[model samples]
Target chain A: MMEERKTKDFPRSDSASGSSDQVVRTIGLSKSFGEVRAVADLDLSIPRGCVYGLIGPNGSGKTSTIRILNGLIRANAGRAWLLGEEVPVHVNICRIGYMPQEMAIYAELTVLENLELFAGMYSLNKESLAQRADALLDMIDLTERSDSLVSTLSGGMKHRVSLACALVHDPELVFLDEPTVGVDPELRMGFWDHFSDLKRAGKTIVLTTHYMDEAVRCDRVGMMRLGRMIAEDTPRGLMESTGETHLEDVFLHKAREGSA
Target chain B: MNLVRAYAIALKTLRSLKHDRRTAGFLVLMPLFMIAIFGYTFGGDIKDVDVVVVDLDAGSANGSVAALIREDLAGRDVLRIGTSEDRDEGMNAVKDGEAWAAIIFAPEFTVRVEEAIEASRTGSSAAPATVEVHIDASNPNIAQAVVAELQTAVQAVLVGYYGANPAITVSEDRIYGEDAEFIDFFAPGVMGLAAMMITFMLSIISFVRERSTGTLDRLLATPATEGEIVGGYALAFGLVALVQSAVILAAAMLLFQVSIAGNALLVLLTIFLLGIGSQGLGFLLSSIAKNEFQAVQFTPLILFPSILLAGVFWPLEAVPDLLRPVSDFIPLTYAVDACRSVMIRGWDAGEIWPQLVVLAGFAAGTLLLSAYSLKKRG
Candidate 1:
C-alpha cells in the first residue's frame, strides 16, 4: 500500500520499477558532535505504510536520526536511503514531510497560511491546497480559528498546527519528532487517530515519543539507548520475549539486557 | 538557483513584517527619525554669539575708529553687540559666561591708527591699535567662529574707512561644493549609516531568530539552496534600504535644502550595494550568535566602530592619521566616501568606480561566505 502511494502520490525515480522495501533504511549510521556520539553504528529499517515509533530518553539520538534522514544534517559515517533515493537528496524533499520538535511554524502567520506555505513549497496548486488545508484544519480541530495567527494560539494549539502543516502536502513519508509533547490527552488521542488514518491511506510515519502508551500503538517500536537501538520488535513480540506486561517494563528489560 | 522558490521565501519574510505593524514601523521609521533629528539639531552655521564692546577710543575729529568697528559688528548677524562702560566689565561678562567674548578698544585707538598709517607710508615701524579679545574658550569651534567674525568686520573697516593698503590681500576660488552647507556633507553620511543599520541589524537579528525558532531548519528541509536563502533575503533587504535611502535623501534635500552635485540615483545605488553587503555580513555574524539576544549584542560591536571609523559624522580628512587605515578598511567608509563625492563633490560613476568596485566586491564576498556558512550548517 505504501508502494502504491509512493507511485501514485510522489512518483519517485525508482517507483517505475514498483520496488516495495523499507521506506527508510540506514546501514552503520554514526554521527558524532565533538565528544558526544549522537548516533553510533545505528541501523534503522522502516517499511512503507508502517507507523514506527522510536522510544528513547533524552540524548538517545532519536531526533538526530530524523534530522540525518531529513538531510538537515550529515552523519559522520553512514549510508541512508529514502524512497530508494540516497539520503541528502535535496530534490526528494517534496516526497517527505518533517515536523521538528520545536514550534517551527511562523507565529505571525495564520494557521491556514502556515499550511499553505508548506504546501506551496511542494508546488501544490491553489485549489488543492485550499481543500487539503481545510481537511487538515479539521483533523487538527482548528478549522474555525484557521485565520488566527499562530502566536495567538496556546502551546497545545500551536502543536496541532505543526501537525497539520506536516501533512499539508500529503507526502508519502512523514518524520514527526515528539509531535505530542505538550499536547493535552484529548488532542493527543485525536493525533493518534489521525496517524491511523494516514497509515490506512498508505502513508508511512516515523515518529519519536516518550509515551509508553503511544509506543504500544506503533506497528513496530525501536527502543534506543545511548545512541544505539537495543531492541526492535512489535509491542507484543517484546512483551512475550521479556515476559513483561507493560511497554515501559519491556524497555527496562531491554535496557538491562543491553547493559549486561 | 531557482529564483521563484527564493522569491517565495522573500515574500514570506515581507508578509511577516506586514503582519507585525510595530516592528515594521520601527524598521522603516527609525532611520528617518535618526536622520531628521540629527539634521535639524546640528544642521548649519553658528549664529548670534553675545559679545560685549568697551569703547575707550578718543576721536581725533576724522571719525571714531572704535565706532566704525562697532557699527560693522552690529550690522552682521553673527554677533550681538552690547555696550560696557569699562574694559573690566566686558571681560567680566566673558568670564562669567554671560557673553561669548569681549572686545575692548583702548584709549589710544584713533591716534595709534593714524600714527600707524603715517608710519606705514614712510616705511617706518609703529605699533597699531590693539583690540583685546577675552573669550570663553570652553567650546573651541564657537570661539573660532567669534574670532573669524571679528576678523571680517575689522578687515572691512580698515580697508573701507582708512584706505590703507598696507600688505597682501587673499582671494578665493572653489572647484566643488560652491554653496554646500554642513547639511550637504552630513546627509550623505547619514544615508550610508542608515542603510548599514537597517540591513545589517535586521538581517542578523532576523536570522538568529529564525534559527532559534527552527524556521531555518524548516527551510533546509525544502529544496532551496543556501545561496537561494541568502539571495532572497538580500533582495528584500536591498530594496528596503533603497527605499529608506531615497526617503532620507528626499527629505534632506526638500526640508534641509541640501543639494546634490551628482546624480541622486547614484547615491541610492551606493546605499543599496552597501546594504546588501551589510546583510551578508549579518549572515556571517549570525553564525557566532546563539540567539536573538546574542545577535543583538553584536550590533554595538559593529555599529560603534562603523559610526566612529566610517567617517559618518566627520570628514575622513579630520580623522587622525593613525585611524586612516582603520577607516579605509571599513565598508561604510567606501559607501560614505562614494555618496559624499556624488552629492557634495559631484563626482560621476567613472570617477567613483574604485569605491563602487570595492563596495561590489564586499557584497559579493560576504554573500558568498554567508551562502557557504548556510551550506556548511546543513
Candidate 2:
C-alpha cells in the first residue's frame, strides 16, 4: 500500500542502496472491533527518517492503528507496506520494534537481561547484543541499575527500559504507543531527547501520545478522532492554519467542533 | 531460523520463573510432591479389611480347616477377623459396615469335605470343601479380596494336608483383573495424572499471567507467531514432562516395585506427547480464565473427569459398562492404558501403537484448537 502511495520522491538505488524511501505506508486501512470502527479507511505515508506523532484522545483509535501497523491484529479492509514490502501475516516484524502502552519489559528480569532478551529476539549476535545492551544501558543512564530487577525499578525507569528494549536491535523504524504514561517530567524530557537523537541518526519514529506539548517536537502531527484523521500538518503549519496559540487548544477546538 | 529469538523467549520465561517462586516451586516441586504423596500412599497394601467368619463345624478333628484359616490369616493385618455363632450375625456385620465380608461355613463343611474327598477318589462332581463366603458386594476390591483369601486359606489347608495335589482340585481364575495389585495397575494412570497436573495447571496459570500482564500482547506484536509461542512453550514443558516422567518412573520402580515392561524411552515419548496435549488444553482453558485464581478454579473440572473416568486409579473394565465409554473419551485413559501395558506387561511400540496414535491425535487436535484460539478475532 505504501508502494502504491509513493507520489513523492522515491530514494534511488545510487543514493541509498538497500535503504527505504518510505519507512511505513498504509492504504485504506480499516479495523473494526465488533461494530465499532477503530481505524477506518486510513492512508498514511511516513518518510524513512522523520518523527511522526499520532495524537488522539482515549479510544480515538491511536492504539488500534499502532496495533494494526505492528501486525498484532489484521486489518479488516486494508494493506500495509513496510520498507517497500507488503505487510503479510509473516512480514519482517522484527525489523520494526514496537513499545506498547503497557510497559513491555519483563519485570522479573534485570534491565540488562531484558535488553539481552529483546536484542536476541531480533536475532542479534551474542557480542552485538551485549554491546548494544551496554550502550543502551549507558544511553538511558541505567548502567548503574543494570543488574537490578525490573520489578524493583520505578515506573520511569521501567519506561526507559521499555524504550531501550524497543531500540535494542537498532531498528530503522520504531512505533511507540503511549510511551510517556506514568513518567516524570525530567525522564520524559530525557526520553524525548533520545527520540530526537534516534531521528537524527536517520531512524523513522511513529509515536502516539495524548500529551499535546510533547507532540511539538515531532516533525509532523496527525490529530485523529473516532478512527478518522481530522487534521494533519506540521505543528507550526497547524498553528498557522488554525491561528491557535496552543496545540492543546487546537485539539480541544477540533474535538469541540466534532472535526477530529 | 531464529533460534536465538526462541531461546531468548525461553530464557526470559525461565528468568520470570525465578521471580514467581510459587510457580517455580509448582513446576519443580509439585511433581515431586505428587510422586511422594501418591507413591507413598497408594503403594501401601490394602489394610484393615473387616471380615466376619461364621464357623459352624463343632469338632476338633474336623475343625482343622478353621485352625488353618486362623493360622494363615496370622500376619495379614488387613483381615480383621470376627467370629459369630450364627451366620445371621456375620451377614449383619457385613450389612452394618462392621465388616467388609462375611465367611459362612456350613454345619457339615468338614464332614462333607471329607466325604467329598472320599467320593472324589471315585471321580464325583461334588466339592471336597465348599466354603461359602457371602461378601459385601459393594466394593469389588473387598469382594475380590474376600474370595481370594477364602480360596487361599482352602488351598493352603489342602496343600498342608495333601500337598499341591489335593484329593479334589480347585481352579482359580479372576473375573475382572486377571492378576493385578491396585498399585501395579494404577501407576501408569498416576503418570498421566502427574503429567496433566504439571503441564496443564502451570501453563494455564502462566498464560493467564501473560494475558493479564500484557506480555502476550507485546509478544504478539513481535515477529513471533502464536504457533511459535505456543510451540516454544510446548518444548519447555515437554522437557519438564520428560524429567518428571523419569523421576516418577524411577520412584515407582524403587518404592512400588513397579516394573516397566515397555521401553522407558517410548513411555517418555508418550508422556511428552501427552504433555503437549495437556499444554494445548491449558491454553484452550486459559482463554476462558481471566486470572490465575480462576485458572486454578477451572483446573479441578479437568482433574475430576480424568481422575474418575480416565481409568487412572481403576481399570475401565472395573467401571460399570454404561460408564466405560466415558473412560475411552478421556485422553489420560489411553496414556494410562499404554503406560501400564508397557511398564507392567512389557508391551512394545507395536502393541501400544493405538495409544500412541490416539495421543498424537489429541496433541495435534488440541494444538490446532489452541492455535485457533490465539487467532480468535472476537
Candidate 3:
C-alpha cells in the first residue's frame, strides 16, 4: 500500500536535461540549545526535485532540523541555502509550504476558512484565493466536509485539511512533518500519491516520519539518530549495505552501528 | 502600516467572537456587571450616622443649646438621637461600635451660657462655646466624617438661634460636581476599571493559549514578523476596546444618567489608549507565564497597584504627598484622571493632553517591550 506506483519511473528534474543548480544546500550547519547540540556541524546538498524522507526516533533532532530549514529557529553556526538564495536572508517564506507536526490549523475555523487564512498569509488575492482554495479542497477529497469546523473533524480528516492549507498557496517547496501518522493504509497511500504528483510537477518535498515501511516510497532517505544523520541512501542501497531484507531491520542495523 | 493585514486580523477576531456567543456576551456585559456590582455595593453615601446624646442640662430653662443641638441633628439626619443617663453608657456604646459618635452636654452648660452673657454686658468678650464629643477613632473615615457633620450641624443651629449675627463663619461653595451622586463620581472610574480588566485578563489568557496550542510558533514560521503579529492583535483588541467603551458609556448615560461634559469621542479615545497600554502589559506578562494558571496568578500583581494607586476608589489628593509619585507610573492613573476630568470638570482633549501623552508613552513602551520579550531565548 505504501508504494503508489509500480513503474519506478519517477519524473526526473527538467534541469537534468541541462541546467545548473542545487535546490537546497547547507554547509557546516549547526544549532545548539546552550550546552546540548541539537544539530551538529553538518553538510547537506539536495538536488532540485526529490521526495526526501528523514526517518528518526523521537528526540533525534529531526524536527529541529526541519524547523531550522523552515526558518522557525536559528542555527548557531554556518549557513543554509534554499533554492539559490541563502536561508534566513533571501528566502521568501511564501515560496515554501510547511505542514507542522502539531497540526497548527485553527480549530475554531472551518476547513475552508483555514485554507483562506493561509492563502491570505501568502498574499493571494481574493479572486484567485477562492479558486486555489477550492482546487486544494477538491484535491484533498475534503469537499464534502469543507464547511465543517476543524475541531469537529476526525484526526485523519484534520490531517488532510492541514495538507490542503500547506498547498493553498501553491508553494514551490513543501515540508510535510509526519503527514501520514494518524492516517490509515488507504489514506496514507493516497497522501503519498499526492506527494508523488507534486514531485512530478518539479516541487521539492521533504518529510520526517518514524515509519520505516513508508521510507521505501521516497527517492532518497536519511536515517538520523541522536542529533546525527547515520545513513543517507536509497532504500535498496541501505538494505544491500546492511545485508538486511527489510528496511526496518536495516534501520536497526544502522542504529546499532552508529555510523553507517 | 500594513493596515490591510491588520484589518484582516481584526475582522477575523471579531468573527470568532461572534461565533463564540459566550465570549461575545461576556465582552458586552462583563463591564456593565462590574460597574453595577461595584457602584451599588461599595458606593453608598456616608450619611445619617447614629449618635448617642447625654443631656444633663435637664431640657434647659429656656430654649437651650441642648435643644438646638437635637433639633439641628434631627433636621440634617446627621445623628439619630440615643439618650443615656450615664456618660459611661454612651462611651461604652461608642467603644463597642454601637454608635458612631456621642454628644455630651455638661451639667452647668445653660448656667455658664447665661452667666457668660451677663458678663458680656460689662464689655467683656465671651469664650467660644464648647461641647464634648466622644467618638470611636478606630475607623478614621467614620470618625472624621462624624466630626465634620457635627460642626456643620452646630454652626447651623447657632446661626438659626442667633439670627445670623455670628462673629465668625465658614462657608463652602462647590464649583464642579455641585450635585454629584455616588454613581456620577464612580461612572468614570468604572470605565477605567472595565478597560483594565478586559485588556489585561482576556489578552493575556488568549495569547498564552495561542502559545500552548503551537499556533503562535506556526504563525511566527510564516512571513508574519513579530511586529506584524503583535500589531495585528493590538489592532483587533483596540477595536474591541472601543466597542466596549461605547457600550459602557451609553449604559451609564441611559441607566445611571451619568453626564459627560467634554466631547464623548475623546473619552473613547482615552479608553482606547488605556486598552492599548493594558494589552501591551498583558502580552508582556503572558511571556512570563508558562500556562493559563500561571497567567492568572500574575493578574493580582497588576490589579493591586491599579486599584490602590490609580485613584479609582478615591481622589489622588487623598493619597499622601510622599506616595503621590507612584501613581504616575500606574497606567490606569492616566485613564481614570482623564475620564474624570472629561465627565466632571468638562475638560476637552486640550486640557487632558498630559494624561493622553502619558498613556500613549506607556502604550509605546510596553508594546516594544512585549514584542522584544517574545523574541527572547526560551
How well does candidate 2 score on lDDT at residue A71?
Answer: 67
> For each candidate, what is the lDDT?
0.81, 0.76, 0.74
Error of 1 at B320 (Å): 1.8
Quick one: ranking by TM-score, best first?
Answer: 1, 3, 2
Residues B28-142 of candidate 1: C-alpha lDDT, one tens digit per residue:
7667755653453344345567778889988786878778888998887777788898988887776544677788777878777788888889899887667777775433444
| Clash list (residue pairs), candidate 3 | none
- What does fnat come to for each candidate? 0.66, 0.45, 0.48
Candidate 2 segments whose C-alpha is farther than 4 A from its true place: A1-20, A89-91, B1-180, B375-378
All candidates: CA RMSD (Å): 15.3, 13.6, 15.0
**Interface RMSD per candidate (angstroms):** 1.6, 1.9, 2.0
List chain B TM-scores, each candidate.
Answer: 0.59, 0.58, 0.58
- The native-contact fraction of candidate 1 is 0.66
List runs of model 3 lying over 4 Å from the truth: A1-20, A89-91, B1-169, B318-326, B376-378
Q: In candidate 3, residue B375 scores what lDDT?
A: 63
Q: What is the lDDT of residue A168 in candidate 2?
A: 89
By TM-score, the better pick of 1 and 3 is 1
Pairs with steric clashes in candidate 1: none
Show the lowest summed lDDT stretch of 10 residues, model 3 chain B: B165-174
In order of appearance, the predictions have TM-scores of 0.73, 0.72, 0.72
